[model samples]
Target: MAAEQGKVDPMHQFAIEPLFGSAHWEIAGYNIAFTNSALWMAIATVALWIFVAGGMKRELVPGRWQMAVESFTGFIDDLLEANVGKAGRKYVPYIFSLFMFILFANLLGLIPLPLALAGVHPFTFTSHFTVTGVLAILSFAIVLVVGFWKHKLHFFSLFVPHGTPLVMIPLIFMIELVSFMIRPFSLGLRLFVAMMAGHVLLEVLSSFVIDGLNAGATFGLIVSLPSFLLMIGICALEILVAGIQAYVFALLTSLYINDAENLH
Candidate 1:
């Protein structure tokens, strides 16, 4: 029981550890460690590929699986079209991939897996700022490049309102530029904060249940019942959050692109 108390650290799951234990290596004078975060990222990528690519087919009369896949495709298509107008057609594939990858990464952490093999751990990539920061930066870069490619110097006008006073123009530009630069960090932070909080909450609840069961008393079991039920409810909520965060990330990216294109 003391060992269990020692092991039940809620924030321990977020720690990034090397895959090769202490057998560390360096390439070109840089420490290139294969961490648990990398393992789960690769897992999420392969799972996404198997799910989406393996399911592709050509059939006029679609089966249930095919229908579900098509529905997802159509849903993303509509999202792109609605948010970015006709120009958004080119971005459907990118947005769809981003959404699915994030959804898979977020949900992978909720699974209670024994990852002790080969120096691995249950990792939620999206819960880490490093992972989410890269994703957000990539999306922001795409919006910036495409905006300038399509509109050139006119893209700068995104900061200025349609009818701003001459005196306020410079102030508005500074404000807008600051907000624009903050978007990627904010996007990444939002996902990381939410994922980290949910997982920690689950960990704390599970620890209580564990302690109760270890007690081996009727009252312990009785109290643990409600804790178990609460964990179940939290699991369901986390699932919903997983999907919603993916959708929200994609939606916000699309909206940013829309603003860049239309300058509103």
Candidate 2:
């Protein structure tokens, strides 16, 4: 659909367009062509690398770039230490990369670039459940592997909390096990829904602004003005939400790892 049609189709932003000309690579009957989502993810990865690389310049007096990187490193370090104690330190590299990757991806999607002229647009891969689900599963898999490897069969004890009544052990174990299994779904859904909802709302309000302004002066003043203001507020809120979601994902992952590392 044309950009003009986006005023009607709020979901146009979320469409996954193949980068190549209508050609899809298929293996085992599944299409896996290069897409805008993959492109954006690659862009995010490169951006992150540049950001970290810039901060790698060690100096006698640390510059803003170095300080900024150190600040984030310390923040993640403290978060993991608080959650999983000293053992959590080992997982800092993974957790930090995960947090920064999500943060960069979320923020990159919100950039209002003038790429429309180039037939290019910013895409939020995180808005898709597949992307988020893979991330969640990665974290969950680490927890499972670590738990089973370190604690052996005792990892199952994580499902049974301390001081449970003997009679309620069966019921509590079932409930806890179910909840444990649901973690990946919930983790993925939370980020996906949050990102998608914010973008959809912004698109809808943008459409209203365009339509109202095009209609008449009265409509522009009554509808477009308010919608424009609300859109600005939502844009700001979404930026904040972007960071919060990254933090929440990393924090929860650390906490989950704590269950594995310490069995608490």
Model 2 clash tally, residue pairs: 0
* TM-score, model 2 to reference: 0.95
* Residue-wise C-alpha lDDT for candidate 2, range 96-199, written one tens digit per residue: 99999999999999987477557778999999999999999999999999999999999999989999999999999999999999999999999999999999
Measured against the true structure, the TM-scores of the candidates, in listed sequence, are: 0.90, 0.95
Stretch of 10 with least lDDT, candidate 1: 112-121
RMSD of 1: 2.7
What are the RMSD figures for all models against the true structure?
A: 2.7, 1.6
True-vs-predicted CA distance for residue 123, candidate 1, Å:
1.5
Top model by lDDT, which number?
2
Per-residue lDDT tens digits for candidate 1, residues 61-160, read: 8877778778887888999999999989889998999898899999887776455455456689899998899999989999999889989999999999
